[model samples]
Target: MEEEYTLDDPTLLLQAASDFGHHPGVHSDASAKAFLHRFPLPVIINGCKNREVAKGFFMVRGWGKQKGSFSEVGCCVQTEDNRGFGFGEYFLEESRSSREMVMEETGKEFGFWEDLWWGDQPLGTQYPRLFRVVVDKNISISSVLGPSRPFSWNLNFRRNLSDSEIEDLEGLMRSLDDLYLSPSVPDARLWPLSSSGLFSVKSFFLALSQSSGSPQNFPSKFVWNSQVPFKVKSFVWLVAHKKVNTNDMLQVRRPYKALSPDICILCMKHGESADHLFLHCSLTIGLWHRLFQLAKMDWVPPRSIYDMMSIKFKGFDNSKRGIVLWQVANIALIRVVWWERNARIFEDKARNSEFLWDSIVFLASLWAFCSKAFKGIPLNVIQLDWIAVCTP
Candidate 1:
């Protein structure tokens, strides 16, 4: 025999509010806010329905300036529209027993964490101007959930929520509810939505640090080529992204470049740049010619750094092996020249063009043998002289 009972009015009301708040398609009006306020759940559910209402609610609840706790979490999440909805769903899906266990284990209520994270000030208020700058095009789950900024997360958003929006935020408290109602308890854990486990200020920082941009423009082959060593590949990745501190880039970024010598260390005449260092430097030019000569190929250097690393061989064989060999040589040349430049700067040592060329050949062949799948290329390239092995 089962107990016969219908769902109570409070349960039905809770379901209605959760459904309304969690669905993005459903517009949140003043009436909805008024209704939710009556119930007064522990969690503020519909705060993120729109920017204005969210800010107003925070200000009214004395959470407007909250810095690092759950309020801070809620504030950050509410900055954008959809994040609030996603967060609410995750919050609602979590069971009360699990939340209690997490609270017990951590010895801090959810509000304590909120205040701890967002502490005494608002992120949007402090960096209102820089908000847009931090958010990448493809917003990920971490971007919404974590309060810490991204690697490129320098404060620079275009604008912040307006005064009218802040003024208008009202009546969001009623929708706040625990993840589950009576009888059905869920497993205990923090950050049920996050696979990494644990949600702390440090984890928030990790999330911001891990936030990355869209991969639409990422050069996959140039950075991830199998023929190059991981170290060399990383170096090239920095070069491609223009993050390497070449003299030309340094001059633009820092005031020290104005006082220091801006001339190329390799050329001693021109300004050092990714382009001149790899392509146009007098010393580097000879190395490129030597590589083409060794491969029994003729070539004219490309103008840009990207083109140099990724140029298609127009009149050459264009075979997979040929392309791989060319890129290997290209990456090797870049690595050795950059290394030579650094050696001159840091160690006060310099190598001649001939030594540099030999180093390129040795490195390219060694990396090819060690890092790549060697099938058709000669085995003697590793066993014997790479110059003799590569050249026909």
Candidate 2:
């Protein structure tokens, strides 16, 4: 017998009233004005005063044994809505003995945990959830008692009850399927904001989601690409390094100079392309090569930082190597890259391959050794660029 029941009465209270020439009802005009007492009353009493549901319930004056308990006067109260549903009357009129029988028989046959973190997640539809900014409240439950005893539970839709259980011990076969409920919104808070990285410039950048396309470049959590978040911190540093990379040279005679025309100030041969100056160009490649040699590693200049981390090393375990390299390189590369950027911008000249190589080597060695010794991770020069930790 699979069934669910609701106690048909919506009010959950019984109502009764009598005619109004009321006798022992509340009627007082005086308030709690501190001063003299035992004075003649200014106002008189009548039938019943209008009342709303509120908390100033009563006042107790006579101390215990000051008089007798029975002498403690209680002014009678009445409601115009006739909702004086007395608790004493309810039990005598509708004694729910039926529930006792059901509970005694159903015993421990039906049970489940309260799953607070139930909801439809927006990403990776099959997975539970990923971006849980708040605390997660979820529960795990075992199979229900089946085909042996009849038991049932229901969530009142109006009451907004969730994490409920239902069981049908008689002629039941299938296990109750796990489900997630929709979440509710809380009021917009005027609460004090904590300085827990809340007012970051990263957040300021994130606010400009639309409107400006070219100048606006920050991550958005709402319409997020899975690849974006992992690259965010590095990307932010990379974006800031632009002034460091180009320095005062941003006022180029033209934004669109043919690669064959304007010569690269570094290589002294081919023209400068945003792509070429940062990559493929001989001057930068030489710097990278010398840096790699100092670190006693073979030279392999990736087209971009994105490709840099993508290149795999063969000497170590695959998964561990990538993660270790990334962890180490993430900060070290950003710092060094910004340093290179500053040298070009402020110094008005790029360092020679040897000098650049020495800097890279120093950074790489210091970070790599620290990561291995203290952090138990490895980082390489290439892995330090603006790249993601995960592909998906």
Cα TM-score per model: 0.47, 0.29
The 10 consecutive residues of candidate 1 with the worst lDDT sum are 170-179
- What lDDT, from 0 to 1, does candidate 1 have? 0.51
Give Cα distance to truth, residue 297, candidate 1, Å.
3.1
For candidate 1, the per-residue lDDT at 101 reads 14
> What would the per-residue lDDT of candidate 1 be over residues 49-90, giving only the tens digit for each residue?
465564554344322232212321211332334333112212
What's model 2's TM-score?
A: 0.29
Best by TM-score: 1
* Whole-model alpha-carbon lDDT for candidate 2: 0.31
- For residues 203-313, could you state the per-residue lDDT of candidate 2 as single tens digits? 333443333543333322211221123354445345433432342244454456433324556666765544455555676666555434433467556665434433543
Query: Looking at model 2, how many pairs of residues clash?
Result: 4
* Candidate 1 residue spans exceeding 4 A from truth: 1-218, 256-259, 314-316, 375-392
Q: Tell me how far the alpha carbon of residue 79 in candidate 1 is from the true structure, in angstroms, after superposition.
A: 21
